[model samples]
Target: MKGLRIIVTVKQVPDTADVKIDPKTNSLMREGIPSILNPEDKNAVEAALCLKQQHGGTIIAITMGPPQAEEVLGEVLAMGADQGVLLTDRAFAGSDTLITAFTLSRAIMKLGKYDLILCGRQAIDGDTAQVGPQLAGFLELPQVTYAEHISIEKGNAVVRRGLEDSTEWVRVKLPTLVTVTAAVNAPRYPMLYNVEAACDGSRIIIWGAQELKVPETMLGLNASPTGVKKIFEPERKKKGQIITGDPKDMTGILIDKLQELNML
Candidate 1:
């Protein structure tokens, strides 16, 4: 059985726990921070692995970042992916989500035929949750976002969408894209036997901007109009006050405070 060909996109992100924002520019202060495989992308890979197990297929993990990003690809392969592709080049440096999606589309196009593309709902560092949908747009493929559960049925992908208030179920056509959340499945650790192959340089296929056949004009910063890339949250120095009272009294006090502040 020629298994499904899955293209799973992964990322190496600054561990958000230790990541901080530059107060001056209001962007991530990434210097000296450690990089780790994005948490959610692991769920994306797990989804692919489950599908492959259910219906024999090939899992190809892909990522675009500095060459150090290959480390994450190796981890993906160890977790059961058949192959890995690293997109690295000076041209792709400092790319925002939009440009990142375009570059990934180029790589995926180069990969030839694929049955499905899976991605984490969002990268923790950015938290914008835009790339998967954007890549789907570039590829002109149908997509389902915030997927919590996925299963193949009758040549279609049955997806469970986790929304803020309620759940939704939808069946999408094959050759589609789905951005999964951590709820999809717990990622399996890499097997010891696969560790060696995963670490070997020969297993990773490196591709540069030239390999993707993309032009300089369309590669990075110029591809996006919004030049600013920043995420900022102002520090709050105010202290909280505790109120010991009956429920009704507390509600009344809250209402009074809101009214005093012109916030009600």
Candidate 2:
């Protein structure tokens, strides 16, 4: 069997548990906060690595972010990706999902040929779950989303999708795009030896707008159709009622309160 050429899209996002908002700009305060590879994206990389192991193929991890985003590429490299491609440019800042999909489509095209493209179902930050499907539209390739299991047989990809209530199976031709859910597989920790090589930066490739040759007008915020109007924390509301009574009396009081509130 010929080796498959696979590409996995990954992202660096602010840790959701510690995320902060910029009061002034109404954006994420990412300056000093910690960032990590989008969790689901790790599953995507793991899926690619598994396929590569079974079919004897190459795995290339790709991401778009600021310079610091390269850290994610290195992480994927340590996880067994053969190469890492980082798409970064000043013009790509403030891009929405549409523009992001377009930019990634351009980068994927530049990679020449590929048998499959893998992506996380959604990024934790945006959770829009639109980029992977939108990128499939841009590339005009068949796509399967929320894939929990994937296997290649005779050049076709057999995928089982994890839905809210049930599962769906589909077989797509070669050169398809798949957005994998975290349920697909567990990601592996980087080996200590590979971690060192990944950090050394030998297998990573960096591309800017100049190298991608995309029209400057279509590169960033200018091309984005959506903009954040405002961002504010939801007001916290508190409610409490006092019931002073012994245990038995408290039970009666609770029942009365529930009944008063229209409960049985």
Number of clashing residue pairs in every model?
1, 0
List TM-scores for all candidates, in order: 0.89, 0.87
Cα TM-score of candidate 2: 0.87
Considering summed lDDT, which 10 consecutive residues are worst modelled in model 2? Answer: 15-24
Candidate 1 Cα errors over 4 Å, as ranges: 23-26, 229-231, 237-264
Give the residue spans of candidate 2 off by over 4 A: 234-264
- Give all candidates' CA lDDT scores: 0.91, 0.92
lDDT of 2 by residue, 124-200 (tens): 87779999999999999999999999999999999999999999999999899999998999899977788888988
lDDT of model number 1: 0.91
Error of 2 at 205 (Å): 1.1
